[model samples]
Target chain A: MSVRQTATAVRGRYQPRISLWWWLTKPSYLLFVLRELSSVFIAWFIVFLLLFVRAVYQGEGQYERFLDFAANPFVVFVNLVALAFVLLHTVTWFVLTPQALPLHLRGRRVPGGLIIASQYVGWLVVSAFVFWLVVGW
Target chain B: MRRRRPVEPLVWLLFSGGGVVTAILVPVLLVLLGLAFPLGWIDPPPYEHIHAVLGHWIARIVLLGLCVLGFVHWAHRFRYTLHEGLKLQRLDAQISLLCYGLALIGSVWAVYILLFTG
Candidate 1:
C-alpha cells in the first residue's frame, strides 16, 4: 500500500468518539466547563452596561426607561444569575492567578494564598472607591 | 494539510489580559450594578451623574477597552469549549474564524457606539 492509503487506513481504524455527556463524568470538568460558560453572561453584562451608558448619554427620559427595563423582575433575575457566574469567574480567576503569574520575593516564590489575598484587598479598595464616588461617603 | 500559523500566542495573550481585566473589574461592577443598586443595598447613582461620568473621554476609553477585551476573552474560551466539548476539531478553521470574527465585529460595534452615540 502507498503511504497515503496506509494513512487513510490508520485514520479510519482509530477514530476516537467523544461522548456528549463527557463533562458530566467529573466534578472538576463540570466546574471548568461552567467557568468557560460564564463568559457568555459576562459578555451580556458588558453589553448591558454599554446600553445603560448609551441611555444615560441620551438624556433623562431614556435613562429612566433604561432603569425601568433594568428593574423589571426578569431583568433583575438574569442579572442575579449573571452575578453568580461572574463571582465564580472572579474566584476561579483569582485562584488561577498565581499560576498565570508566578512572582518571587527574596528569591522565594510567592505563595498562592498571598496572591489571592492581595486580589481580594485590591477588589475591596476599588469597590470602596467606586462606592464613595457614586453613593458619597 | 493546512499550514499552521503562530496565532495561538497572540490569542493567549489577549485571553490572559482579558482575564486579568475581567477579574479585577467584573465583580465590582456586578456588585454595584447587578446587586446593590437593584436591591437598594446602595442608592444607584443619578442618571445625570452617570451621564457626566461617561461623557468624559477617559471613562469612554476605559469602557471601550473593557468591552473589547471582555469579548475577546469570551471568543477564546468559547472557541476552546466548542473544540473540546462539542468535539468539533474537524471544523477548527471555521469555528476559529466565526468566533474571533464575531469578537472583532463586537469590538468595532462597541467602539462605534461609544464614539458616535450620545
Candidate 2:
C-alpha cells in the first residue's frame, strides 16, 4: 500500500465510542455515575463553606447577608439537591470501601460486611461528635 | 532540571483520603450549616460562637485540609468522568490541566480564607 493509504488505514482502525448515557443501562452503573457527579456538589459545598467563613470573618453584617443569600429559595433548592447527591456519595463510598481497601486480621482477611459495618460505626461516631461540637459542649 | 516524581500516587492518596473524610464529615455539616441554619430548621448559632470556633487554629488547619483534599479528589474524579465516561479522551491533556489547575486555585483560596482571613 502507498504510505498515505497505510497511514489512513491505521488511523481508521475501530475505536468504540461510549455513549454519555451508557451508565443508565444498569442501576449500579447509574449509581456509579451519580457518585462521580456528586463531586460537583461536593466542590460547591466547599466553596459555599469558604464564603460563609469569609462572611463570618468580615462581621455580623456580612454574615447576615450570607445567610440571607443562602436562604433564597433557589439556593435552598440547589442545596437540598446537593445534600441528596452528597449522601449518595457518602453511602456508596462506604459500601465500596472494603472492595477498595480490604482489611486483614491475624493471617485472615476480614469479612467485607464487617468492614462495611465498621465504617458505619465510625460515621455515626463522627456525626455525633460534629453534632455535639456544633450544638456546644 | 531536578528529577520529577510521578504525581499519580499523590492524586490517588488525596482522592481516597478526601473520599473518606467527606463521607464522614460533610453530610451533617451540610445539614446544619447549609440547610438548617439557613432554613430556620434550627436556630443559628450566635456569631460569637461561630467566630470562636473558626478562630481556633486547629479548626483552620482541619478546614484547610478538607478543602485541599476535596478539590484534589474532585479534580481527579471529574477528569476521569469526562475522559472515559463521556468519551472525551482526545481532550485529556486540556482536561487534566483544567481540573487540577482549578483544584489548585481552590485550595489556595481555601488557605487564604481559613488561615489568612483570621
Candidate 3:
C-alpha cells in the first residue's frame, strides 16, 4: 500500500464525523446544552447588575435612568426569558450537587433529595431576606 | 512529543464551585431584580438604599466572586460542549485558550468595576 493510502486509512479510522443534531437525540443531552447556554444569560444578568451598581455610584439621576432602561418592555421580556433559563440552570445544579459532593452521615450515605431540598430552603431564606431588604424595608 | 498533565480534575473543581455559587445565588437575584422590581410585585428600593447595600465590602466580594466563578463555570461547560457536541477536539488548544481567556478577562473587568466604579 502507498504511504498516501495508509494515511487516508488511518485518518478515516480515527475521525468519525459527529452529527450536527447529536444533542437532539436525547432529552437529557438537550437539557444539558440548554443549561450550558443559560450561562450566557446569567452573564448578561451580572453585566446588568454591574451597570446598576455603577449607575448607583454615579448618582440618583443615573440610577433612575438605569431603572427606566431596565423597566422597558423589551428589556423586561429579555430578562424574563433569561430568568427562566437561569432558573433551569439552578435546578439542574441542585439536582447534580449530591453526586458532586457526596456526604456521609453516621457512616451511611446521605440522600440526594435531602441535599436538593436543603438548597431550596437556603434559596428561600436568602430570597426572603432580599425581599425584605427590597420591599419591606 | 511532550507530555501534558491531566487538567480535567482542576476544571471539574471550578465547574463544581461555580455550580454551587450559581445555585445558591442566581435564583433569588433573578426573582428580586428581574421579576419583582419590573413586574411591580414588589416596590423597588430607593437608589440610596441599593447603593448603600452594595457599598459594603462583603457584598462587593460576593458579587465579584459570583461573576468570576460564574464565568469560569461557563468557560468549562462551553469548552466541553464545543469539544464533544461539535467534535472540535482537533482545535482543542485554541478553544481552551479562547474560552478560559475570555473568562479571565471578564473576571478581571468585573472586579475592577465592582471595586473602583465609585
Q: Which residue pairs show collisions in model 1?
A: none
Instruction: Tell how far residue A130 is off in model 1, in angstroms.
Output: 2.3
Worst 10 residues of 1 chain A by lDDT: A1-10
DockQ of each: 0.57, 0.52, 0.52
What interface RMSD does every candidate have? 3.0, 4.7, 3.6
Candidate 2 local lDDT, B65-108, one digit each (tens): 88989898899889988976887756878999999999999999
lDDT of 3 at A137: 62
Lowest-scoring 10 consecutive residues by lDDT in candidate 2 chain B? B1-10
Model 3: what is its DockQ?
0.52
Candidates ranked by TM-score: 2, 1, 3
lDDT of 3 by residue, A77-128 (tens): 9899988988898888888889978989999999999988998998888877
Quote model 3's iRMS: 3.6
Residue-wise C-alpha lDDT for candidate 2, range A1-137, written one tens digit per residue: 64533543566684444567889899988888888999999999999889988998899899889989999999889899999999999999988899998888898999999998988999999888887777575
Clashing pairs in 3: none
- The residue-by-residue lDDT of candidate 1 on B1-118, one tens digit each, is 4345798888898888888788778777877776777777877787767777778898788888889999999999999899878877678899999989989998988898788888
| Candidate number achieving the greatest TM-score relative to the actual structure | 2
TM-score of chain B of each: 0.90, 0.93, 0.89
Candidate 2, residue B17: Cα displacement in angstroms equals 0.9
